[model samples]
Target: MQKVIIFTDGACKGNPGRGGIGYYLISDAGKTLKGSKSYLRTTSSRMELMAAIEALRLLKFPCKVELYTDSRYLADSVNKGWLNTWLASPFFLNRKNEDLWRRLANEMQKHQVSIHWVKGHSEQAQHRLVDRLASRACNSPKPLIDPGYFFKI
Candidate 1:
């Protein structure tokens, strides 16, 4: 399987304000892809999860993915078995960011994924780059509407 490494970050102007998600993807074949999108209104957690979902969605075929994020909510959900517990539970309506979680879960099944947690604003260049990208995205003038945040879908 093709091996790929992804670094993701999310930035929010305020807790429930403008948010953005960023991701950087590098493949074993020396290919690179990067993206950032700003949402009109959302939470940091939603942006974090969206980063992973968007990154995985970009892949054209199934591959081995090493997804790195600075958010504990994102990393711990997968690493600490919280995602499986949530999926198995019937109380999905009570879960926060259930829409993004379900969307992320669907994208994850398309590949072999491993989620890694990294310290925010770390010395790593890739991590810092993604951080900057996310920050910039949130500050963009033309932000897109976040339906999930507005409609709670």
Candidate 2:
């Protein structure tokens, strides 16, 4: 079975404020697959989910994927099945990051994926790289699009 590894991180200048996501993918033989950073004028949760969704969508082949993210919200929601219930009735009260979550759920169905939560800013090399990328994306002067869903809130 082909195997891939992904590391993802999200950063917010302020809660519900400017944010970004960063991710890097590696093949089973330790070859780099892809690395990306995205800016968002929104919350960290959305960035977190976007990171995962974008990483999954970047895959060119169907393979067993092991994804790592620092966000418990993203990791637990998927691994523990909470995301499925939310997708079933997405309009429930207190729902947030709906668009990103929906995108994540859809991308998730395309591959055999497993999520692992890692401590942010820890000793993990990939996590550290993701953090650096996310910080750069958040601090970069480039104009960012307001992820659209914020106006619906």
Candidate 3:
């Protein structure tokens, strides 16, 4: 079986205004699936978490996955097991993006996944692709961009 690799990034226009999550998924045999979507009244961090959530959800069955992301908040939370500690503490009650973190935790339980923090805007071409997709989405409000918007992707 082929390994599953996912590259993700999130873009925000105004921090608390609109944001987008971009994900690039590729299988070991060269098959690929990738897209980005914009969300109203969302933060980049939320979208960062959402990108991973949506990317993992693409799998019909669990497999070994290497998820690459530019956001340290997303990577460190999962890879360092900070999410576990948060879930057990009252601090999680007031933590930002708790809902997404919980959802991420649930999605993670279903697969053999590892989160890797990749430096933003480096030599990785795929990262640039995801960044472009996400930024494009963040620049709009539908119809003018694409009909399906990203629901189809």
What's the lDDT for residue 132 in model 3?
Answer: 89
Give lDDT tens digits, candidate 2, residues 1-153: 689999998887876666777889998887885455556567777778877888899887788999999899988998898988887773643577676777887887888999999987889988999888877788767737655445542
Worst-scoring 10-residue span by lDDT in model 2: 144-153
- Pairs that clash in candidate 3: none
Q: For candidate 1, write residues 1-153 as lDDT tens digits.
A: 999999999999987899998999999999999999999888888899988999999999999999999999999999999998999999976798888888999999999999999999999999999999999999999998888876663
Query: How high is each candidate's TM-score?
Result: 0.97, 0.89, 0.88
Candidate 1 TM-score over all chains jointly: 0.97
Query: For this target, which candidate reaches the highest TM-score against the unseen true structure?
Result: 1
| Best model per lDDT | 1
Ranking by lDDT: 1, 3, 2
**lDDT for position 52 in model 3:** 93
Query: Which ranges in model 2 have alpha carbons more than 4 Å from their true place?
Result: 90-94
Q: Residue 95 deviation, candidate 3, in Å?
A: 1.7
**Tell me, what's the RMSD of every candidate?**
1.1, 2.0, 5.4
Higher-TM-score candidate of 1 and 3: 1
- Candidate 2 lDDT at 141 equals 75
Local distance difference test, each candidate: 0.92, 0.79, 0.82
Residue 53, candidate 3: Cα error in Å is: 0.7
Name the candidate, 1 or 3, with the larger lDDT value: 1
